[model samples]
Target: MTEVSKITLIGHSGWGPVEEAYEERLTVSAAEVTYRYHPIKATAENVAHRWRYWTDGPALVNAFENLAAVVSTW
Candidate 1:
């Protein structure tokens, strides 16, 4: 048998007043999760790459959840 552990990381950046606080709450709610601000030069290329790895690419054995937002739509 293999041991498995699931971790959900909610990356939050460029959030408004409301959502910004919401992210904080999520961080507190999670028992063991990582949270951080994306780098200034995190462009689309890096975003896709990170997402793929975070979700375990080419395996379909792991799962991930993304909570991204656009200021224009908020």
Candidate 2:
């Protein structure tokens, strides 16, 4: 398995933080990529759902690609 970098995706919409853990892991492919992406909501799911509206189509893919590129450079 490859190493994945954990990143916190925070935003006012709330989806960012909730999806941070999964997204970071998926993006980095690391085992223990811990992220603390939190929105105004108390539940992680709430924050994650926000991502639905915050990002659509290529936005998420583009963001993930950009993050992977930056990490590879580092």
For lDDT, the strongest prediction is 2
| Tens-place lDDT digits, model 2, residues 11-59 | 3442445433332111122222233434344454544322222334565
User: If scored against the real structure, what TM-score would every candidate get?
Assistant: 0.19, 0.28
TM-score of 1: 0.19
Note the clash tally of each candidate.
0, 8
Please list the residue runs of candidate 2 whose C-alpha ends up more than 4 Å from where it truly belongs after superposition: 1-56
Model 1, 1-74: lDDT tens per residue? Answer: 32233434464455544323322112211123344444444444433222122332433332222222121123
Show the lowest summed lDDT stretch of 10 residues, model 1.
63-72
The prediction achieving the highest TM-score against the true structure is 2
How far is 54's C-alpha from truth in model 1 (Å)?
20
lDDT of 2 at 11: 30
Error of 1 at 62 (Å): 18
Candidate 2's TM-score reads 0.28
Name every residue pair that clashes in candidate 1: none
